[model samples]
Target: MNTNFNKMMFFYTMMMGTLMSMSANNWLMIWIGMEISTTAIMPLIPNKNFLSSESTVKYFIIQSISSSMMMLGVLLLLINSKIEYQMILTSSMMMKMGVAPFHNWILEMTEGLELMTMFLILTFMKMAPLNMISYLTFKNNLFIILSLIMGSLFGLNQTSMRKMMCYSSIFNMGFIISSIQINSIWWTYLILYSMMLAMILYLMKKMKIYYINQMTLNENKMSLKMNIWLAMMAMGGMPPMIGFMLKLMVIQLMLINKEYLISTLMIMTSMLVMFYYLRMSFISIMFSSLMMKWSMWNTEKSSTWIIMFNLIAMPYIVMLKT
Candidate 1:
């Protein structure tokens, strides 16, 4: 009971901090809110193992440096109000969000965390930094390009599911950063991404899947395999999926703004991301254990829900497009 209460408190603190940062009008308040969220999340990182301990320490060190940079940038902006100060602040927030070039830490750290904790890091923990980033006037095209390139290139060879998700998060961050100017599209992409990620992680956690190879071990569970692959395809922005529609909106927004080059780059890198998602999906569906005769036809309620959720957005996509 005490442990559960403690966890609840930490979650409460984290939520309050994120809300504070998102709602703050001033730089100081933003920085304070970030600090609160960072501190609150620290307690939740460690899970009594060597890897978790290492991840916690790394998370702390990186966050401390990011917070310091943010504070320095805020102070400089207050005094001089230069573009460079804004750049520094923007870079700091990007670092906090684990955008590429500052992204290796997130991959390593995620490998050590429990699925739920990693899910929070990938989704909710990003909210404050994204909100902070939206307030910045300068948007660095170079970071967006680098994020897409690195996220795609690095993810192609990864075997671990955790690391793959980290890379996907990085790639998606590029899209999110590009669409930051349009609040409606940005929030919609985020919400859809979060939902897809939640479903994938939940299924992975339930099935005890940590790597791509482990997926083939569950030979009899076709329903679970179908659920995972469908989620992956949705996340990879396959045509007709909600994710594809979300990306389409972002691309359309970019085109309207005359950012043809970035839009093209986003499309190319998305295909790269889709390659690995297809690879995983194929492995889950095509590969099987030696004991084929022992296979059982079983389905879970969660699997049904997942499939329904993936398709339910189809009508909305049509409405949005028209």
Candidate 2:
């Protein structure tokens, strides 16, 4: 009960911090909020392993460096507003978000985190920084290109599910950043991505799956296997899945803005991402172990509801598109 209370307090602190940052009227308030969120999340990162300890330390160090950079940018901007300072602030937020070139820390941290912690980092923790970025003016074309390239190429050789998802997060960050100018589209993409990621992570956690190969070990749970693979395909932005619609919205917006080059790059990298998602799905479906009992076939009600929502929601998205 005591431990649970402590965790709840930390979680509340983290949420308050993020809310403060998002609603702040000034740079200093934003910085304070970011610091609060960072400090609050530290205790929540450590779990039942040495890896979690290492991850907590690494997370602290990285967040500290980014926060310091943000402070410096804010001070300089107050002294004399310059585009360089603005760029510095933008870069710091990108670093905090684990955007590529500053992305290695996220991959390492994901390896050690519990599924819930990882989910928060990938989705909720990103909101404050993303909101701050939207208030800045920076040429994100280079960041977009680098994130897509690195996320696609690095993910291909990864067998760890967490690491692969980190790469996918990086790739999706490019689209998120691209859509930032259109607030509605940006929120839409973020919400869709969060839902898809949460579904995949929850399924993986329930099945005790840490790696791609582990997915094949669930011998008698075909329905569960199907759910995981379908979630992966959705995450990879396959057509008819809600993820594809989300990406298509971003791409359409980019084309309307005459960003043909970035749109083309996005499409190409998405295909590469789809390849790995398909590979994982194929492995899950084709390979099975003979070690589990037949009675393990029961699917959880929550998971079934999630899958049913995915199926039911896609048609509405299609209709909206038409």
Model 1: which residue pairs collide?
none
Residue-by-residue lDDT tens digits, candidate 2, 160-228: 999999999999999999988777778878988999999999888778888887876665366777788
Candidate 1, 143-181: lDDT as tens digits: 899999999889999999999999999999999999887
Model 2: weakest 10-residue lDDT segment is 289-298
TM-score result, candidate 1:
0.94
TM-score of each: 0.94, 0.93
TM-score computed on alpha carbons, candidate 2 = 0.93
Candidate 2 collision pairs: none
Computed on alpha carbons, the lDDT of every model, listed in order, comes to: 0.86, 0.87
| Residue runs of model 1 more than 4 Å from their true location after superposition | 1-3, 81-83, 289-298, 318-322
